[model samples]
Target: MKFADYYEIMQTIARYGHALDAGTAPFDQIFTDNVELDLTHAGPPGQPGPVIKGRQHVLEAMTGSADDPHTYRSVLTRPALSHHTTNSEIVADRGDEVEVRSKFLRLGNSQPGPMPILIGQYLDTLIRTIDGWRISRREVISHGP
Candidate 1:
């Protein structure tokens, strides 16, 4: 991949963390309309994660439910949440698309300071569109049991 492609891909990944931290939805700028979000590896020790398809569904998943406000599903609604990414590897590089594997450390502010929340891996496939790189599919895998 060219330097620009690599940089842009990383930027795309960075944007995810920033968006979450800011609690903003830049859907069209970050994902494709037919995006698939697979959180099968993000559930409890052995529980199955929810697999959400379509952009609107993914948006709803991120927005989460108001009734159960403290659940992981409502993480986006929490304040002072941070996501840091590292070990971004380009798994495949096509002319117009690329696959990336990366690790993230999620932290949340506590009375003492920032506390580790979850360590996870992001498996993403991004495509170059008129607007720039947009994630078409994303699978989140948690490192914690």
Candidate 2:
């Protein structure tokens, strides 16, 4: 793939981080309409999380609505900083389709401590659309503290 394409993909990942930190609902822009989000590996030990289908479902999970009681609004509103570092490697680049394996480190400083709250890796599948490159599938693998 061209460097521009690579940079664009990287930017998309960066945007994902920004949205999460800001608690903004940018799912529709970042992911495809029928995106598949697999967070099973990120679940607690002995329990597997369900694979979420559709952009709307993923958006709700990421940014809960005002009417949702179990949303992560409290956490997102904290006076903390979140950083998402991605080391992405392009596995395949077939013109309109791209697959990337990215090692991600998500750090959150919500308290007066020098530690992170979450860390994970993402296996992403992206497709080039009329708007731009959007993620179609993302498999999250968690590495806990």
Write model 1 residue lDDT over 1-145, tens digit each, in one string.
7898788889888887777666666677778888899999987777978988877777778876323222233346477777788999999988898999999898887899989888989999999999889999999999882
Give the whole-model CA lDDT for all candidates, comma-separated: 0.81, 0.76
Superposition error at 80 for model 1 (Å): 2.0
> Mind giving the per-residue lDDT tens digits that candidate 2 earns over 1-145?
7788888888877777777666665665689889999989986787888899988777666656534423245344345657575778889989988998887766656456746766778999999988889999999888874
Overall local distance difference test of candidate 2: 0.76
Q: TM-scores of the models, in the given order?
A: 0.86, 0.84
Among all windows of 10 consecutive residues in model 1, the one with the lowest summed lDDT is 65-74
Residue 86, candidate 1: alpha-carbon lDDT: 91
Highest TM-score against the true fold, candidate? 1
All-Cα superposition RMSD per candidate: 4.3, 3.5
Q: Count backbone overlaps in model 2.
A: 0
